[model samples]
Target: MTATTHTRHDPAAATLLRFATAGSVDDGKSTLVGRLLHDSKSVLVDQLEAVEAASRRRGQDVPDLALLTDGLRAEREQGITIDVAYRYFATPRRRFILADTPGHVQYTRNMVTGASTADLTVVLVDARNGVVEQTRRHAAVSALLRVPRLVLAVNKMDLVGYDEAVFAAVADEFTGYARRLGTADVVAIPLSALEGDNVVAPSAHTDWYSGPTLMEHLEGVEVAAGSPDAPARFPVQYVIRPQSGAHRDYRGYAGRLASGVLRPGDTVTVLPSGQRATVAGIDVLGTPASAARATQSVTVRLAEDVDVSRGDLIAAGAAPRLTRDVTATVCHLHERPLRTGDKVLLKHTTRTVRAVVREITYRTDVDTLERRDAAGALDVNDLGRVVLRTAEPLALDDYADNRRTGAFLLIDPADGTTRSAGLVGETSAWGAP
Candidate 1:
């Protein structure tokens, strides 16, 4: 099928895109990423030379492109990616931050970390193998995390003679599965990462295909526009007070705006304290500003000294639900099992409170999309639901409504090791029931 063509965008005025790559082991993810960087002229001479020397030491005539992203020594020796390797590069039409995540099933937690903040995820598939179990797992994880876009990269097309029929079958099967998982925006492309086909440029071998190259699609895909209409959420990180200065009485709450816009005269409420105040002033980088938007680190002066402190949330417009009971979908990251009645520390934005797991509702089988009910415990890499009761009240939004304010971490209070990553609210179709 021919893909729609987009108008060429200007390179100088392009925006940044954050994307990630994931697939089963040996599906050529790292090689595809390396080729994307090399062909786009994003690689430096010294880096290329290092890769070449490493390839020679391994007794290879040609450079192994996978070496570019497999930075860990154990990974290089094992010929498998164990951790997520992040790379930044820019094309003429766009800039990108690419996270090359591990393809091994045991390291699925690493994939979650890489894709948590990604706007898009490229799921690679070897033409010979089609869509495997790991591929479905990655797609389910992406769907659960609410990754807006997906790319079904059919790699190793050369091994299948670049046959349109082979590509079509794989794409159709994967697309149907992704749609079932509630991932609607999926684009499939046929390419050979080893031969550099349809990656940075179109492939002559696939003359029947008339789709935009991977680079072109990446350059033109729409990213999520900032949440300007959502209610403003700013978690107070620090309380700044001047002792000896022209502004000795300057009192401001310092933190990055998590969402929406904050402006002078805007009415806000401090969470947990339930005190109301108006935004008296905004200071950006020591200079007074008229307004502050999402992600901007600014100090906001309140009209009333409402006894705000670290771990407090300053909200505008709509108020978040303040509660001690939280039902959340979580992915266990630690080897120690998370069981009911286990005491853990829940770390939300700027706030850490003691919590106990009340129940393990169920565990979801990613491959089958089935819910295993009455699960007693969650092992490492398990996706499940949990009911948690905290010692103090927390102001929180649903993960679907606000990712920044709705996400949190569960930590082992004794050693401070992060045990799980959680999202507040009900599970989606692909997640726990």
Candidate 2:
């Protein structure tokens, strides 16, 4: 047997958790990220030395802490993060992949791309500034993305003398606003990212507050294992079949479990066709599973032959509702603008289909949290309600119900680049047609 055939037996290997950081300009997002890396000892000694040298060149009293994360030369000069810089670190508890994203008002698309796969979001806020427009915008994006957990890291607490009142007010303001956007669990913690207070370890300065440190909370938070409780949504990527072997009868449906659970003996129905079959085998990576849960990319073997193809979804419970007409709230992140009647491609999970923008309902003012009607086109960083008519039927769920099923990204068909991020919701009458 070949090496590929021999190594397909092990199932439990490693787990990956992705998280993102967001906040307004100079709110210490990159600083907190640098601190996390610095405190966790994830940075190399050589890298630290380089950053220190660069800091000294700038004539700072201390290392310009932001230097640790601002990798691009232009970013350092501009003193702003312009792209998503991903860093990895681990403790004995769990492995983490952190996407340190840009915080400028113009880079909302980059934020969406980074946060799309994140299980949690940490929105940093300056304690002195209570809550700003970007704070609300970040929180709104977190809610729209269906990020399971939200951590309001109120940074620069020391600047406010670590006063409990300042922390309380900022926390209350953010918590109240987040609730309006449907964030279920919000944890607020005050810290000075630059001073190493309450980031990885607890500081004695805040005696009135008693909560787990950021590191501890990250280690203990229970992330849902692959959305197994949701209805199974397997977007068929490819059909596996063997042609020239003694065991030539092998045929499998290969795809990742987008949501819900699938067991070997469970009966499943394929969407678009509604054909049914019994799952005879489940293969994770290459190893077979007696049962398979959500988020696992496994190849499934059916007991009976069935006609199935790519872009088709298979499920055991009630299938995701199929629709060609969709209304959704979207964040326009493309350099090019979005206008009604524009043709584009909508990619949801593993499936992509042609779609046309039917209407632009209203643009959301991130600063005031107000909806502006009579907007002509959605510009970069603009959030608006949109309606789309697809050329093909999509198996979609409410974003609040199942994020993996309800969320989609719009792609510009001409260049094959993503143009917008959308969350399924209700429609209005005022959108431009």
For all candidates in order, the CA lDDT equals: 0.89, 0.80
Q: Which 10-residue span in candidate 1 carries the lowest summed lDDT? A: 1-10
Candidate 2: Cα lDDT at 413: 94
Superposition error at 201 for model 2 (Å): 1.7
RMSD of 1: 2.5
Best by TM-score: 1
Worst 10 residues of 2 by lDDT: 1-10
Instruction: Residues 211-247, candidate 1: write the lDDT tens digits.
Output: 7789988998877645789999999999998668787
* Number of the top-ranking candidate, with lDDT as the measure: 1
TM-score for predicted model 2 compared with the true structure: 0.89
Off-target runs (Cα >4 Å) in candidate 1 are 1-14, 73-82
Clashing pairs in 1: none
> What is the Cα-based lDDT of residue 355 in candidate 1?
100
